[model samples]
Target: MPRSRMLEYDGAAWHEDCFLCSGCRKPIGSEAFVPDNRRFYCLACYEQQVAPRCSHCRKALTKGGLTYRGEVWHRDCFLCCGCGSALAGQTFTSQGERPYCVRCFSSLYAKKCAACNTPITGFGDGKYVSFEERQWHQPCFKCSRCSVSLIGSGFFPDRDQILCADCNSDD
Candidate 1:
């Protein structure tokens, strides 16, 4: 009769030779293993067959990772589609299922302010005013003649220029 050492796991005693990995059917002799659905697997087999894969690189995510839009990704794989920068712990936006860093997103997609002709990124609590399909930053929304703020007051649109009511009367 042959004798072998035994190990106990999850209240079940398993002979070392009999403790085989469900994936490769190799003996799991004291090495780290993963248990799933009452089946045992070695680290290699578990990583190959059970670990979540990165959506971008299609590699097994054996450690810390990220999830976006219900898809999984490794930390190094969650990159901005625009500039190819890492987006972990950083502000980002998505367009057509791809991720982009804030700076890249603003440059590529944000609306341009009509008065200043600069991108009006709606970040950092910055406010803007939109009028007749044109947009402007709060500070840029002013009368062209007197430079008076037109917010919360009536103004006149005069040939691609905004004029305060007082300034419009003088024109």
Candidate 2:
């Protein structure tokens, strides 16, 4: 522990006070000690216990990995829940803790239009009209006869169809 007995490493003299490794409490003289979280670990402990691991593969992430929703995943291990497609660098949706692609998510959860028999996704100018607990597209809502728009206007229900006030009176 004397200055005359100090060991020189990397052009600097290291004393006995800093000679012990944090993991095994063993003397680390010239051996490399990896620093992690402000604590130094021996080579064996660093590779076995202190290294970061992927959540999906459960293996040590040797290269760069991604952290999504607080879960770590390697590039090849990040996949969609619905189609099992790769989700790396792609937009995804989550159901509970499972990740799914946009196309798969829409097909599974999108609402369909009752009048047009097509999915009524409210994207852009596609608007939905709800009447009598039934959903219809804006362009599809019309009277059965003469095909007149009945939105925000007086209309009558005839049998299994909707009719405009003028058409209902005429009939």
lDDT scores for all predictions?
0.89, 0.76
Tens digits of per-residue lDDT for model 1, 27-111: 9989999998999889999899998889988988888998999989998889998889999998888778888998898889998
How big is the positional error of residue 132 in model 1, measured in Å on the Cα after superposition? 1.5
Clashes of 1: 0
Sequence-dependent TM-score of model 2: 0.55
Candidate 2 lDDT, tens digit per residue, 1-171? 556345555566657566667778887766877767656677887767877788988887656889888978998899998889999998777777888777776677656666667765555456877767566788887988989997888888776678898899997
Best by lDDT: 1
User: TM-score, each model?
Assistant: 0.83, 0.55
* Model 2 stretches astray by more than 4 angstroms: 1-21, 24-34, 42-44, 114-171
Give the per-residue Cα lDDT of candidate 1 at 55: 93
**Which lDDT value does model 1 have at 107?**
87
Q: List the residue pairs that clash in candidate 1.
A: none
